[model samples]
Target: MSFRSRGPRTVPLKSAEEVDAIVRKIRDDQTRPENYRERSLKLHGWICAKCGREFELSNLHLLTVHHKDGNHNYNPPDGSNWENLCVYCHDDEHSRTILADYLAGKDKKS
Candidate 1:
């Protein structure tokens, strides 16, 4: 009827090894340069490849990185696979692909 009478008991804590592993994973992820958006912006300049729109720090959030080959995971360190696009152009780029697939009957493949 003392402290043991509390509603729900506390869950068991993680072991030291488990905690260390989690910390190491977080550190590794933070240090990794997998953010292709930043690299693309640096390599291609702050302009939209298709629409010729430019961006400044105030409107930089509208800039997006696009993969030329349509694969998001195929980022190249040399920036060969990346293009900086404004949000509108990026949406249009993807929309064309969707429209083409629909017209070509490729959408039914799945």
Candidate 2:
């Protein structure tokens, strides 16, 4: 008997409402900024920079863009904020920043 693999199927386009929900989800503070999303995807291969794992768009629940300088207000006018980063890596970057600051403070106290 011959075996047929179902493989994968493409779903129909999302309804307007569904799209809106996704937009709102991405707008959350933890998500990468919209203006920079596409750019980040291109730069980071749509993968988490920290983990080096590839992810589908649907699986990008925690994918985010991070500013190295820690200055959200300095977002350039040209949409440079887009820097694809996987969830774990993005969190690590931010966490590392905080930890460094904390250690520095402790050092001062010492």
Candidate 3:
């Protein structure tokens, strides 16, 4: 007597055209800077994520949306890639990222 064994079915990969379409859709979605900022503000409110500074409607312009992973083209629908930062904190955060990269390069060289 012989027993038959079942194997996992393989899923079909996306065609090149389908992949390109998906990439274009993602790029279009992420390139909407204004929409992401509005959605981030709605998700995180008027408080700065870094410094906890609060903004009122009169000064809401001071609040800016920062891309957490440093990739401006990675905006997700859940606002996971965003943080609301006051202008000062946003500047500082970028400065820190630059400094960290420089230090890492120096360490690698050493």
Candidate 2: RMSD to truth: 11.7
Across 16-84, the per-residue lDDT of candidate 2 in tens digits comes to 999999889878845755555665566667676667787886887668877756676666645465466
Off by over 4 Å in 1: 1-31
Which residue runs does candidate 3 get wrong by more than 4 Å? 1-34, 106-110
- Residue 90's lDDT within candidate 3 is 97
Model number with the top TM-score: 1
> lDDT of model 1 at residue 9?
81
Candidate 2: list runs displaced more than 4 Å. 1-34, 76-82, 106-110
Model 3 shows how many backbone clashes? 0
| TM-score of every candidate relative to the true structure | 0.70, 0.52, 0.63
Worst 10 contiguous positions by lDDT, candidate 1: 1-10
Per-residue alpha-carbon lDDT of candidate 3 for residues 1-110, written as tens digits (9 for 90 to 100) = 99887888889999999999999999998886668989999999999998899999999999999999989999999999999999999999999988998887853654
User: Lowest summed lDDT over 10 consecutive residues: which window, candidate 2?
Assistant: 75-84
Give a tens-digit lDDT track for model 1, residues 1-110: 55655688889999999999999999999999858898999899999999999899999999999899989989879999999999999999999999998999999956
